[model samples]
Target: MRLRILSADERLQEAQGKTTMALFGPSGAGKTTLLKTLPTEETVCLDLEAGLKSVQDWRGDSLPIRRFADAVDIACLIGGANPAAQPDEHFSEAHHAHLRAQHPELAARLDAKRIVFVDSITDLTRQAMAWAKTRPEALSERTGKPDTRGAYGLLAREVIGLLKHLQHAPGRTVIFVGILEKVVDDMNRVSWQPQMEGGKAARELPGIVDQVLTLSLFRQDTDQDGAVSWQHDAEKGHARRLVCQSGNPWGLPAKDRSGKLALTEPADLGALLTKINQTLKG
Candidate 1:
């Protein structure tokens, strides 16, 4: 196969300065809470579980259809939420369009300062599955009907494409929050590991993300007088040490043999970002 090459001018204009980050952890580990602190106008959350509204207190903001086509400097919240009346129904295209229409003046703001957040792609997979079930034609394999897996693939592809586009934008950052799942190791009867839920989508994530951090809770015991000093990762057995660089394609080593990113008390997001920036700069 012959490879086609871009001209000098084309090569010069190609955008190559962008980074993506992924935060993975158990529920209630404060992953989404930590992400809320980043400097952004709006954190576009794709709430797969419909939990964001209750947890984050997000009200609908309207952006006209025309404006959405050219939106910049906007924080986009994209997520699937369960409807109040139906309880089982999740946010769909009609809901998304309604929210977009509420925020009309948002179009002219399309610049690099934008941020996109996908809160829990795992839930999105569930929503996709639910959507697929409603389409009988999509369920026929011989007719090329989409199954739950196919629906999931389509949704994952769309989300990933959106993430890629946002990352390519100058001064833009995209954060993906995923749920941790437990799996038993067949090779070692006593060994177990945690990972994201989606099959192929989860596998493809690490390559695209600039940083992958796993947040865990820790507790500590203190001497006499009941001085209980709490710590993060007390359950993991490493207590005294804080903030260990676990996995880095940039050569940063893990603090211990556990192969997990060790975070210090107070969870220093800035320091983590600094380390990542340095690696990219080098």
Candidate 2:
């Protein structure tokens, strides 16, 4: 079969495309609440954490992700199929075709939305780990003992595959929200990481997405505390800010692969999307 080459116009048209972002922050930092800032008509939340109570008042459509299979099915439906995957792979062409045929309505619903918001990847990792443990690879053949390490390996592949599939979805903006964890080393050195069952997925997530945003409350001072307060305290300065670019003084985990965002931006997601789109056009 002869390979079809993309013309200059096709390449340039592809360059002006959608974005895939991963938003991370400590719990109670209003990461989920930021969904309210997105256009309700064009956005659909994949509620994996069951933590949409914060945005209960927001009138937007949401699909609850009850299990790991649900996540895989939804991702395949939204992103189509993985052409490079093996025939038997979960997100392979055959599997995706089966899913689309089985659930046409679900696919149609998701097709109408431009933005796919996954509530929390932290929960997705946990569920994936659980599902991985049930697989045959998680057990020692001779000893019949549970292999924790094997399960984690499978969990990482599952999570990364789902994320990459959605990241490549055409004409759609995919946003994955996760928990930011504070870790202390043996020497008392502290570092921030995304909460995941396996280290590999957490470490490689920043590379898989276009933007890595850290949503947190910033104060005038350099003091860092893990707490969320809505009321403004005159004595204690605290305001929610979205850290957009990397290498900031705050040491937050953030990056803009498009090279279009400022060091810091407002917490409003709608405005942020507009800014990113405008930069893409420019």
| Strongest candidate by TM-score | 2
Kindly state the number of residue pairs that clash in model 1. 22
Measured against the true structure, the TM-scores of the candidates, in listed sequence, are 0.55, 0.90
Please give the range of 10 consecutive residues that has the lowest summed lDDT in model 1. Answer: 64-73
| True-structure RMSD for candidate 1 | 10.6
Tens-digit lDDT string for candidate 2 (1-282): 446999876754665658899999889889999999999999999999889999889898999987998899899999988888898887899998898899988888899999889988999998898899999989988899999988999998889989999988988899999998878899998677888889999999999999999887766443368553233222343788788888876667999988888787789988988887777665
Q: Among these predicted structures, which one has the highest lDDT?
A: 2
Q: Which runs in model 1 stand beyond 4 Å of their true positions? A: 1-17, 40-46, 52-104, 108-113, 132-137, 141-149, 152-156, 185-197, 218-266, 278-282
Cα displacement (angstroms), candidate 1, residue 119, comes to: 1.4
Local accuracy of candidate 1 as per-residue lDDT tens digits, 79-145: 2222231432223335434545775444333332345555665554454445445655346577765
CA displacement after TM-score superposition, residue 90 of candidate 2 (Å):
1.2
